[model samples]
Target: MTDSGALQKFLDGVVVDAAVFSLRPDYRAVLLPVDGLVPGPSDEASEALLQAAEASAREALAGRTVEDLPHVVAWREAYKSFGAKPQRTRNSLEALLRRAEAGLPRVNRLTDLYNAVSVLHQVPLGGEDLTGYVGAPRLVRATGAESFDTVAGGVPVVEHPDAGEVIWCDDAGVTCRRWNWRQGRRTHLTDDTTTALFIFDALEPMSDEALQTAADDLAAHLLRLGPDVRIVRRLIANDMTHPEGT
Candidate 1:
């Protein structure tokens, strides 16, 4: 599962120790099952979770103005390392909400909740169906020439070159999700998803705690939206890209 040929040649002297998280259910260590396209939010628990996230954002920004808002516009626009630019213009929770509400194909509770936090935190957040995901959930710095199979509109998978950093959802010669400022559409959550691996990052020394808290909050939000969701703190040796001062 390690890199080789062109990838190996390019990354020759640089050996990066990737910190990966294996998220599997106690009963099913191979994968976590989540119903695709069907988010359990149709039930009372799901509704409460959605309302809670909505309420939290409203409260957090209760006193903040538009300009004062720490939106991820800069991160979104600048995060084109994968070479594909995400087409989100309105970069705000409110804007995305309006778009979704206007009926842009709502899938499952997990998807909805994850997207909600994305706008709320103003950071590029995403959750993947870990059931089918393989290998390590390590962040990778691609080099040389490599292609990964992804499903966002299903075109050329995102490319990570040597020295360029991106998240890997694999063990070797593989990448799970790339953290290019924007979220990946391939491993997006759906009603069919039973288990998920979420990424809520604050790549700064001061923001480590903040990111962790945000991730936890997001997990809770999702659990409330879907079936039982229990989160455990995961440590990745290669998680340097997350906290400040690798």
Candidate 2:
């Protein structure tokens, strides 16, 4: 299938809506819609990519720390503005970079690919199962009333984000807390996930060209999952209008 065909399949089951508000004027986001995935354990080729990405990350980190990286510094400040302790709850990009400095764990094919890309590009990237989505996926300030499904003490539990927190949610509840800190269990990607939404969150110092490059890389890697895979992409910015008819 073509990229548009895969994107249409992903959009068939649910409406995906997203926006960025109350963020620094330089904040940017790229949303990639993909469908016809065959999620499963990491194959040898995928593992090789992950390994190469880790090596690249390690080499990049050799001269400086994660905090010194412009992208990570912007994210840390963004988290601080939202009342999140960056040291305690590191953003996904920071966490992944730190792990890469040591070694990256092989999760699954989908997870490994995204994680590798995130570290390599120095951007926060996430994949969520669209089939599990309740309604349109949105990025808005949390009201502290949306329920977030998570695991606590090895058991499932529900939690809520602080009022005015930056979050990604659907009609059901928070899909990700603190922009990219923690992902809810409800919409997490799994081996059965056929359609998925990938989020690439960016700030200043991360240019539009960089964002597009990351999205393109992800789309290409996703195609490795199956010949029938499809993908669609959109860029969300403070100055841009809603992505429609384009």
Candidate 3:
């Protein structure tokens, strides 16, 4: 199937188990499936964006700490709800904030851009290579049977999420474990990815307007990546709201 077709199909099958909502009714995600993008190593443009994000992070935390940030506080509680230790396994947003004091990793153009955007909006965002996914994406409390590919001691290894730990997965296995703590190697974005999926995770204190603003900022940056870039977005929550493109 084409990129758009596959994304639409993925959206059709997207499921956030009711149990997950029961854990945190305020939890929501902004799923953006985009195609027709060029990809390359991190360049000066991405570097500039990253620098701006670093400054933004510093400004946001000038007189405060990551744990004191409202969004980070909300996410920490959310992680605890699903049996994960927040301090040990910080959410993506907290992880980025902590790293911003030094410098963010310059992975590649796409990854760097999204990381910058995530930091800019103070939201947890994840980008994946759509081609690496199997079946449709799902958010559920893991049963400990799904495989999670990763590197350990510089060697590749497979692990599983703890039973009842919230995870993002597909038919093949887990794509992300502990909600947003870590992304699997299988679906991680790389320089070769032309079509990608970006997920923005939000919780209480992050208004819908704020989430939409973040999504809009991300889409704007994405459209500048390539001439033919196309994006479709949807907000998945109890109401299952969809943006215009979706």
Candidate 4:
């Protein structure tokens, strides 16, 4: 299928808005829509990619700690600005880089691949199962009223973000909390996911070119899942007055 055909069908009635970027002018996000993925256990090619990415991450972390990394440090500050404790709720990139020092978990093909890319590029990346989304996915400062679905103890519980906290949400609830620290269980990726939405988040210290390269690398790795996979991407920046298609 063509790019437009795939994106139009997958994104039908699904609007993704990055409203937080308007206020936090230093923020940048790149959205990647992918279709026709055969998600399952990692194949030989994907395994090799993950291995190489882990090795690269280890080498990159040799002399410096995660806190010393420019991108990680920027994200920590961003979290603090919004009332999040970076020491407790570390950003996704920091978490992944730390895990890579020991070993990255092999969750599934898509998750493993994105986790690797996040570590390799030193950017916060998230992959959500698009099919599980209720409506639009938005990044906005919460009003302490938006619902967030997560697990409490052994049971599923519904929670809400603190007022003015930066979060990613849909009509159903928050998808990610504190920018990239925690992802809700509602729209998480799984082995059954066929279509996916990947978010690449960057801050001031991180350049646009770096974000683009990370997205490109992710798309390339995702294509390894299947032969007929199609991908489309859009870059949302602080300079844009309104989000695309809004």
Best by lDDT: 3
Clashes of 4: 0
Q: For each candidate, what TM-score against the reference?
A: 0.54, 0.90, 0.95, 0.90
Task: Write down the worst ten-residue block by lDDT for model 2.
Answer: 12-21
lDDT of each residue in 1-246, candidate 4, tens digit only: 345575756555443344575546678788888888998976676677678878988788788787998999999988888888999999999988888867888888898889888888889999998877777677888999998889989899999899989988888889999988888897889888888899999987888889899999999988877887988887766556334522
Listed per model in order, the count of residue pairs whose N, CA or C atoms clash below 3 Å is 31, 1, 0, 0
| lDDT (Cα, tens digit) per residue for candidate 2, span 45-146 | 778888888998888888788899999999999988878889999999999988886688887889889988998898999999877877677778778998
lDDT of 2 at 7: 66
Error of 4 at 231 (Å): 0.8
Model 4 — which ten-residue stretch has the worst lDDT? Answer: 10-19
Candidates' lDDT values, in order? 0.44, 0.82, 0.90, 0.82
TM-score of model 3 (CA atoms):
0.95
Residue 110 lDDT in candidate 2: 91
Following a full C-alpha superposition, what root-mean-square deviation does model 1 have from the true structure? 10.0
lDDT of 2 at 68: 92
RMSD of each: 10.0, 3.1, 2.4, 2.9
Q: Write the per-residue lDDT of candidate 1 for residues 135-220, one digit (tens) a residue.
A: 43545455545445554565656654344534443533443334433344455555566655655443222154455556666656
